[model samples]
Target: MTDQPIRVLVCDDQELVRTGYVTIFSAQPDMEVVGEAANGLEAVHEATRLRPDAVVMDIRMPLLDGIEATRRLAGPQAADPPKILVVTTFNVDAYVYEAFRAGASGFLLKDAPPAQLVNGVRTVTGGEALLAPAVTRALIGHFAERLRPGDPSRTAREDIVRTLTPRELEVLEHIAQGLSNAEIATALFITPETVKTYVSRILAKLDLRDRVQAVVLAYRIGLAGGAA
Candidate 1:
């Protein structure tokens, strides 16, 4: 919302892909391509130097992969991490999960169209999460594709729930179901602003970076399956 354009760092080893991203971002009035990196290590360095508002990260890169770079730049241990929107291939769902666990705010498939890609960067910077690519929505199954009952994260799941208020728990349920704030507001009969507030509180309470993590936690705890 500020007049200042969002500064962005584009990281991808593919020349045409990277150049396409730069061109798309360049055409946006509200976004500026601030830097570029061919691999994860350079991404870290440029991210450190440019300190961009968001990073358009590809999961595969030379020298270092995007997962490790995302971890170093957006990991829990990062002193002041920049928002990261991981761009990955649909076939490598494992990499997607690892990127999320590594602290990426959200992810888009490498094939996502320009608008969704741009929206992804905005979503992360807006302090919300982005996890949908139309083709990969059901492909990834809302972060539950790899999730099943009885994982180690299940133990932490209760701890995740214990940290939230009752209202926050409700918000988490809707988020896990892939409802937008407006939809959640409609379902809960509250204002969208209230839904947004509850979302912020939920993320803070769970020590999560965004709603994607919140949804993943919900499934991990069986909230979607009526066990939580």
Candidate 2:
């Protein structure tokens, strides 16, 4: 962790939602609410000026929208982007997929418990990503359903799988199955700490940004599928 607090920018069109987040996060000593934006355009401007460590962004905002804002801040065009957490009140599947595709580091339900919210911020700030179990499964399933023989990136994904050690490969398969770290450890008879280490190593070896990416990779490489 850095010596300074984890700075956060909260963006939500609803005043109550923004106030709620600010109130909850500001109570923590390790984090601080650095700024607030009512719309996606303001979010981009505030993000540029404040450069907060993480952003709690809502998907539907006035003017520009979370998807476009996220794309601008953490997408392909970004030079140096801050981590973004997409927290929405809805559980619409398309929204979840779009949030991840937009390069958000994490996704959370707007009503998630305070602890989960806090942990989500910390996870992204630590250069990791977080997705709900349902969202994770959806991402993998989405990719597998569209799998094609002549896909241009197939070979690259296969190469990523080839680099994984035997143990890491096992972990990857379980991740695609939507198992949590503790559950994976229990099923494999390994310690959770060991599972954590394996997960980190798998991400490094596979050139994945986080577990979410690892899940997608597993499905892409045919390790996890309908018959998996």
Candidate 3:
């Protein structure tokens, strides 16, 4: 990480919530609140103009919702997208899943502690996906049909199997299961550094941006399941 404070943009439909987010982010010595938006349209405009390193996004707003805004700002076709951390009140909702598919890098509950919100900005800025385990399980369970075996995407699955080594495939499975690097190390009887290396290799070989996409790919190919 560089010595520069993270530049952040806060977006929410409620003025009070935006103010709280701005205050919290500004209080952190390593964070700078560059802008705030009361709706998704303004969010896209300000984010495009200011070009913050991270965006704290809300799910519901007039005119446009966070999911579409995230897609416009961070989707596959977006150029040099900023890291988007989606914050919502609903825990296990389809909107959150849509936001993830739209290229959000992290998810957090609105009731989460201020520290978690701060860390979420840092995590996304550092190029890591921050999904809570419970949320992951819920999403996987809700979307299992898209990930079930024999979904006529056999060629993609075959390509993944051919691209990754046996060990790398195992590491990918653990990642899909929501295991952290340290937890994966313990489970695989390897060092944490080794797990990190494997994760990097997986991302590079698959051309995925981060662990979130990796997990999605693993599930899509039937390499991982929605098991608790």
Using lDDT as the measure, which candidate wins?
3
- Give the Å error, residue 1, model 3: 1.5
lDDT of 1 by residue, 1-228 (tens): 789999999999988998999999999999999999999999999999999999999988889999999889988789788999888876776787778778888888778889989988888898877456343345335456446667666777677667888888888888877677888899999999999999988887777778767766677677764434
Question: Ten consecutive residues with minimal summed lDDT in candidate 3?
Answer: 144-153
Clashing pairs in 3: none
What's model 2's lDDT at 105?
81
TM-score of 3: 0.93
Ranking by TM-score: 3, 1, 2
| Cα misplacement distance, residue 203 of candidate 2 (Å) | 2.0
The sequence of per-residue lDDT tens digits that candidate 2 reaches over residues 52-165 is 999999999999999999989987578778999998765454666566667788788877898988888998888657556665565556556654334535676577667888
Residue-level error in angstroms, candidate 2, position 227: 8.6
Clashes of each: 0, 0, 0
Best by TM-score: 3
Judging by TM-score, tell me the better candidate of 1 and 3: 3
Each candidate structure's TM-score, on Cα atoms with residue i matched to residue i, is 0.87, 0.85, 0.93
User: Candidates 1 and 3: which is better by lDDT?
Assistant: 3
Lowest lDDT sum, 10 consecutive residues, model 1, at 133-142
